[model samples]
Target: MKAPLLLHVFPGFAVGGAQVRFAMLANRMGPRWRHAIVSLNGRMECAERLAADVSWERVPFAAEGSLPQRLQRTRALLRTVRPDLLLTSNWGSIEWAMANAAPGGVPHIHMEDGFGPDEARGQKARRVWTRRLVLRRAETVLPSATLLEASRHLWRLPEARTHLIPNGLDLARFAPGGQGGDGLPVIGTVAALRAEKNIGRLLRACALLAGEGLGFRLLIVGEGEERAGLEALAGELGLAGRTRFAGHMPDPAAAYREMDVFALSSDTEQMPFSVMEAMASGLPVASTSVGDVRRMLPPEQERFLAPCDDVALAGALRPLLCDAALRRELGAANRLVAERDLDQDRMFSAHASLIERLLMSRAALAA
Candidate 1:
């Protein structure tokens, strides 16, 4: 018998957290599973990370239509591929949820990473109902406990069908104890400067830190549509000399070590990989209390968690950035939390187990 086929649908396959997670799971699971990826907008930048031994197919979803027509198109493809399982991600691919409900559609698992800029405040009534209705039959997976709650209470998803699978990192690869910068303390963050990421607020917060006359360099890693706006904001805030915008780099592990402190200023996130990577790099973190971040960090570090604004985030950053001893102490504690709880082996195994269960049920029904 051939290995079971799992079809993955993503908004785009750039080197984002979701795409990276798919590659990690596929690479580790190896030949035991055959995979197919459908990027709605067709950016396959992360495909290069997949191991050669994995059996896979990559086809950009090259079609345009209204939402209902898109569902019909995806439904037709579902019949053609005849996959054992269909894994759809984020709000962008909710059409697959509709597709899987069609006759002869595959069993599906819909993964909700987080919301786009539009739904930043809360889910709009239309999309909320679409998710509630379309995702009724599928197992909805969320990495954030916060999202998990939202799914159950707000979206009215069945508690039994909702799954919380925290995004995990390859712990050994991002291990701590590397050389760090000594010249000036570095306040760094690795995020595309998107509207939802709220990098502008972070820059303003950096300016706040500077107003207090702290010695630091704000290293803003990654690039996106909001980059120009952020650069101009930095100049306006007099952070032009202090902030360094390093356009997207493939590897962030080395850069984590170069930071005296790590930051996350996002308006929303569901277990961001950068935070885990920072914790694994043994760097103290100062972040807004978004998603499961408050629970994600060590108990003592919770005080540094703030609301989503420049002043609030700056207030959180001040204490950690000001005291070198506190930074060292918190960094050690964060690394221990990563080692104790956030290992990728656990995440990989959890996903493999879920996938295998889905495949086995499909096999049983066929038998």
Candidate 2:
């Protein structure tokens, strides 16, 4: 029997959640599926995160130029790969749907993890119309309930072709460690220093706590375009020494273990992997109310504040930091939630099974 061929297309292979998820899926699926990744822009940073044994491709198409040139490049790449199935992600690669609309008609699957800062809380009609037209022939994969609704209601996609597949995490790698500081409280957040992540809010919140004479250190892990601005904000807020920006740690699990509390100040999200990883690391989280966060977190742990509100965020963080017993209880509950739903083995197996089923169904239709 021949192995199935799956080609994944993205805007760029950077260190984002979607890229990480794809790498994990490719590594875990192993020999059963042959994989190739094509990024519109030439950044292959996330490719390094893939398992050493997995064979993949990194095709870069220049994003600038006339529409004809762009479409021509996309069509050429599709013809070259001749994949059994073509999977494109988000708005950036939606153009691939048009490029792949040839006679043999390779099955197209488009995954929408979430939106960027430009369309954070709502849908853009122009983009939605384009999606409806370009994605009409493709099967849509929505990773969260919020996205599922967006596809069905906002984009008006057909129910038959839209499928919901929740994002999963690696439980074993993120498990809690007993080793950490026992002195002043520590609050931490792990994410790219992007504007949408709202790291500035976290800095301000920490500064407010510092003003109250509560000694706590805020550790931010990950790096991006907003690093310099965030660093400046910390200094401006008089949190220069109280906030530590750890730029792009190879393994964030150690940082999570060191944290007494976890924080997520994103202005937008849909089932963020960082929150799940923190919960798996057995830390209590105080995050903004965005996407399905209120639904994903346990009822007791659901202290969803408005995005970038330092006062509200400080109010939420105070209880978690000041009360040790509550922290232990919340952490234990979070661990249980992670074990029950976010185990990587289970996640990998679920994705493998879904892909197998998709292939089998396509074969039967062809027959």
Candidate 3:
């Protein structure tokens, strides 16, 4: 009885939500399943975050000359690995679906977590056609109901083949009761410094609160291309001393512990792990009503405001920061929600069970 092989393909294996989820699944699956991670861009820092025993490989995508050359390289890799199941995520690896299907058609699973700024609002026709063509043979996995519907109606995927598996939080690592440091109120957000995250909005909101004579510090964690621009914006808004861009912290849980209130000002998101981690750390969140965030949060802590509205965000932030008792109450409520629904072990079990079921059904069909 040979152990099952699961190969996961992604744009990069960096410290992102998808990578974290994959690491959790691979580590917990243990010896029963062999896991290999393929990062198209050769960024495997997140692989280091995985458990020591877990095995993985990094394949850099060389987009040098022609489309055929790229396709050839992808096919060669698929042939060499010959994985039992192929799991590719996002737009960057959609082409791998075509490569997997080209040669003997492996049991490919395409997981659509969300999209970037280009297709943030909805799926474009070109992308939809490409997905329908490339992903026709694979089963689709969507992490949010919003994405599930997009796959069905927008990408025209069959309802039978689509599975909705929400992202889960690690309760132990992100548990509540961590103490805040001695300082003015701290409002923090943990996300990649990408345009979609809209850290500028958070900065503006902080400036508004500060201008109103509130004593608080703003901490923006994580890093990306927008670092310099955001720093300049903070300075321009007269928040040079008050706002801190912490870059990429290895342990964001520690940062979450220091914050009086957590905030996410992303223009687009689908079940952001940062928010879940914040909730698990017992921090009340104020975020834009994007994706399934409203559904994921408790009613009291849902505080979903319009994205980029500094006034509305400022209004929301004042109560959470000034009212100590309110913050504690909301924090307690959030932690309870996380403990009840977002435990990492339960998430790992659910994913493993789903994979097993898929494998069994495929085997039965082959028989």
Candidate 4:
């Protein structure tokens, strides 16, 4: 018998948290399932991470036309492909969810990562109603408690169908020990330079740290449309000398291994993979108190999670950069958490079990 086919729909297949997680899981699962990926916007940068042996193909589909036309097209394609399972990611792929929302539609799962800049502070009522209506029968996966609760009470998704599975990392691949170089401590971040990521906020915070005479190097590892604008902002903030924009790396393990402190200044996030990698690599994190970040770190390290403000973020980074002992202490605690809870094996098992169960149930129904 042929392996079951799993179709994954993404807003864009760029290298971000969602795409990277999909690539990791697909690589691990190997030939257990055939995979089809559709990048709504046609950006397939993250596909480079997939292993050569994985049974997967990218579906050449770009989202076009008005809502009704797009929905009709998606539903027609779903009928033609007749996948064993359909996995739609985030709000950007909601149309796919809507297209597959029929009573006997293919076994569907919707993954909610987080909101974009428009809905960063609060979710739009229109979207709330739409999700509540369309995602009623689908299995909903949320990576953070914040989103899980929102899915239950706010979106009013069925309790039984909703799942809270925290994102995980390969703890062994990221280990503690970046020899604190004599030149300057490296404060690093691995995130797509997007508006919602607010890399500019981080740059501004680092500028404040520099004004206070703190010596450190900023290493940004990722690529996006916002690069030129962010580089300009760095120059304006006088961070041109200290900051390095190391554009998209296939693997950011070395970047994490080189950092003394990790930073996240995004306006929104739900269990960002960068923080998990940093923790596994034993680097203390100073970040905006967004999504599940505060809960991800040890209690002692919560002080470093500041509000989304330049001065507050700077203050959070100050103590971590000033005292070497604190960094080591927090880094050790973070590594312990990663080992105990965030191992990729646990995530692989949970996701695989869920997918297999869904495929089996759908097959039984079909039979």
Question: Taking the tens digit of each residue's C-alpha lDDT, what string does model 3 give over 194-247?
Answer: 888888888888889888898988888998889999999999999999888899
Each model's lDDT comes to: 0.87, 0.82, 0.81, 0.92
lDDT of 1 by residue, 191-302 (tens): 8767899998888898888998998998888878899988999999999998899887777787787788899999888789999999998999999888888888999898
Per-residue alpha-carbon lDDT of candidate 4 for residues 1-367, written as tens digits (9 for 90 to 100) = 9899999999999998889889999999889899999999899999999999889988877577898999898988887777999999999999999988888788998999999999999999999999999999999999999999999999999999999888997887888877366768889999998899999999999998999899999999999999999999999999999999999998999989889999999999999999999999999999999999988998988889999998999999999888888889999999998898898887888888889999989888879
Worst 10 residues of 4 by lDDT: 175-184
> Residue 236 deviation, candidate 2, in Å?
1.5
Order the candidates by lDDT, highest first — what do you get?
A: 4, 1, 2, 3
Better of 2 and 3 by TM-score: 2
Give the Cα error of residue 323 in candidate 2, in Å.
1.6
Highest TM-score scorer: 4
> For model 3, what is the error of residue 161's alpha carbon versus the real structure, in angstroms, after optimal superposition?
1.3
- The candidate with the higher lDDT, 2 or 4, is 4
State the local distance difference test value for candidate 1: 0.87
Better of 1 and 3 by lDDT: 1
The window of 10 residues in a row where model 1 has the poorest summed lDDT is 175-184
Total backbone clashes of candidate 1, pairs 3 or more residues apart or in separate chains = 0
Residue-level error in angstroms, candidate 1, position 194: 1.5
Q: How many residue pairs clash in each candidate?
A: 0, 0, 0, 0
Single out the weakest 10-residue window by summed lDDT for candidate 2: 302-311
Error of 4 at 138 (Å): 0.2
Each model's TM-score, in the order given? Answer: 0.95, 0.93, 0.93, 0.98
